[model samples]
Target: MLEAQSRHGRTVLTTLCVLALLACNRPPEIQHDAVFGPSHGAVGDTLWFSARALDPDGDSVGVRVAWGADDTSGWTGFDVPGKLESLSYVWHDDGYRIVTAQARDIRGALSNWSLGRGVSIGVAPVRPEPPIGPGYVQLDREYAFRAVSRDTSGHERRLRYVFDWGRGKLDTAAVSYPSGDTVIHRHTWRTPGTYEVRVKAITDRVGIPSAWSEPRRVLVDSALGSLIWQYVLGAEVHSSPALDEERGLLYVGCDDFRLYAVTTAGGPVWQFVTSGRVRTTPAVAPDGAVVFGSDDETLYCVGPDGLLRWRHGLADKPGPAPALGPGGAVAIGDESGRIHVRAPDAGEWRSYRTGGRVRCGPAFGADGTVYAGSDDRLLYALTPACSLLWSYPATGRIRGSPAIGAGGTVHFGCDDGAFYAVAPDGGFRWRYKAGGDINCSPAIGADGTVYVGSDDRWFYALDSSGRVRWRFKSDGRIKSSPALGDNGEILFGADGGSFCVLNGWGDLMWDYDAGNDIQTGPVVGSDSTVYLAGTDGRLHALRTGCRLATDAPWPMYRHDARRSARAGGPH
Candidate 1:
């Protein structure tokens, strides 16, 4: 018994000594490499980089490339999709700024120090100078737009242009002009309106912006520039469709003017119809009511049971589509140049008038101002109470709708073959000229870049300052607005029934053709489905690339009863 106790004590001491030695010799783990980038960029712009790290063991390992930006502050990073490759970024903003990048290997390690190769990013690229101009044009009796001049620096300033119509603007690009100056040589617009167009002449040899030009007015026609299409409601069907998300079902409208609900991945479940052409896009109200407008000029609120709860009408036929605003008010324009704002229940409807036909829909600014165009060659800025605030003139008919962005920057295209940017106070910022008419609406990214299509068979990406970053030529005229993905992919349709995806830099990612003209805008749903209505009478729910299958039917984005093929909503 004495020997056994002694042996046990000796074993315990030996184990304790071994542990102490191991603890003293062990080293700390190394940190992973990191990458950083500009959270905002044009489609083809480079991502910035920064590499910082440390190894507790005093030994370092190289970092593997990852995804885009990693945080809300700017751009973040993620794991590389496949092959191991180094990544970089560039800045479109002025001045040099520091950005951080995170890198890693198969081992789950992290880095803190933003120093070393591939760890810390360098400063952004220099801004390309604006184009030069002594060019100008008169759009109509009310306004005249022109391109004055620019500064040449950075890359290459190539082109310049102006619009003085229903929608007015200045044009610029990073390309050289005839005078051997780096300038935005060609700029165009469709409608003429109010503007203050300017360009900073630039080139790789000469850098920075030059003196600005005085403001100008652009004229536009109210009727000719607008694009309207005939719509056919189901002669074989009767009911309106309810977009049921969770069930992947599309409630059908029947030929008997009744409703039919069906599964998206499956088939029809049920449907109900109205007394007239169910040409209206159904609105799922806050109270679970499926409200919609009709050719009968009556607005009806229906229960989930397909029962009508309440109905209202415009004093006359609402010749235009409706805009359902924040408060429960229904807004629509008429053929007689009148705009009606009404409550859900029947009562005296408020009306506002313009100088021409209210063919285009009304857009509400953040301050409750109403913007609508007319055949009278004017773009009227109106008060919420139906009073005219300001009127911008145009050269051709003002048919295009307007898109408002940060700081009240307005974007729209016109038949005058020009794209225009306007300030909140009804002044012009700039414009770009294209070879063809512009019927497409504009899409604004979080970074303030604007994307739009034109009848000139081209799609363009413009920077915040109205400079053309890049342009992609298409086989057919682009009448649709682009649908932007969370990952920065641009999805859109063409007049030739083609669907395509554009990378951040205006490069063609991929495309698909459905064998019919797709005049509707593509909508990106939460379930990753893309919805589009084609002239072939088919509603498509596809992946961003237009190859994957979808589960919904009606993808019309209009908030009113007129879900026509006309280019009204933002595509």
Candidate 2:
């Protein structure tokens, strides 16, 4: 009985195998129900698939759906739809994650996965954003600057900015995202002249600083080819020098305790020893005698041979360079708060006790009224007899000498950072504020306009009302008084180590570099030749670009020159 059953099982298995082989050799029918969906979709988009089976016997059959997750994954069963032919699932939160679905007919017998009836489901890519901005930065005012940055993946981008002048910094500090387009930004000058404004833009990055914008040089005023300066005494000069044409010598003084005699060739020929450093220029008499003041509290009389002739002690620290009055008499001020008058060949005369220390050299008005400024911030008008006529208070200490104007106006710069035009009666006429201290005396023109430089690095032209008519910004501080050319151009020196020429409108005409500070005032020659000395121990000469001449110099007034002479004596 066992043998008969075994034979029967073998005969049935053999017949089934033969049938499967025959079916394998036949071609697939390839019939399928259609499935449709969006050609492209974001992650989480849904898809649909449907199919029906036609098996020679019309019986209910199971249709298994299968898919693969990656190149390493073998085919696995994908979930079937509950009641509808569509199935929805979120695309995994990863880029390029492969997804797939297949539809199969519900057949009673199972068959292998078929390629002809299935479709692929792939994820679409996403675009990433660029970073906000970079590191620290600076830009010019009104400059169109950009802040650029990139993503972790190295995608490039740019940023925008709003510069704030009132704050002297940037307007926005946000780590804002960048737009695809370029943005415009602007900066403005709060004051006229040349300026180095900074512009910066932060990127999307939280901590990185944006790069500085390209330097945009805006000229609120012209600064081209300004003058360069030179020196001849090999020391810091507080007073300007005088050229003794007949003797071909430059008489000047320095804080170095000596009165220097500089030859036109630019080297010291002789030096007169003083009890103290000579801060005032010498007054050369026809007799060749040199008169000046020394901080050692004495007035020095030096012979042309460079010998000290006399030393008149005032018993006070002289802060002013001596000014010449009549009869070779000299007027000098000291830190003792007194202005003294004495004869060139004699000792002390009358002295006036000013309210404060007098640092500036006194000016001789046409009528013998002395005009001078004190650390007390007052401009005093005194009689030749040493009695004060009036005392006017300025906003600050006045260092520059006061020039008498056509309207009886006195123009001078104050430590208040402004130039003032005051009436001889001690009334304020006008004041123009510069960006910095104006320690320079003003050069007055026939038109009532005033010219002066400030620590603000600017040379300015001011109207009678103290309004700025024009201004020129420079690369350095302007501490020297301006020498107006006879034709209306201006000459001045800058801490930038150069003396420059400017047109009437403040346009730069030419410049010469002396590579040193110029503390001396400029003098124009008769032929319009300009002479200025720098701390470099050289005297520079320029021509035709300014308004005054080197020959007939408009007195820079105070006790300004290393030596000033009118007919003869210290007066």
Find the candidate with the highest TM-score and give its number. Answer: 2
Candidate 1 residues 492-547, lDDT tens each? 78877787766555655456675677655654555555555555655555544222
Query: Model 1: what TM-score?
Result: 0.51
Worst 10 residues of 2 by lDDT: 128-137
lDDT score, candidate 2: 0.57
> Candidate 2 versus the native: TM-score?
0.55
Listed in order, each prediction's TM-score against the native is 0.51, 0.55
Candidate 1 Cα deviation (angstroms), residue 162? 42
Show model 2 residue runs off by greater than 4 Å: 1-234, 285-288, 343-348, 527-529, 541-571
lDDT of each: 0.50, 0.57
Per-residue lDDT of model 2, residues 149-180, tens digit only? 33221233334343433335556744355534
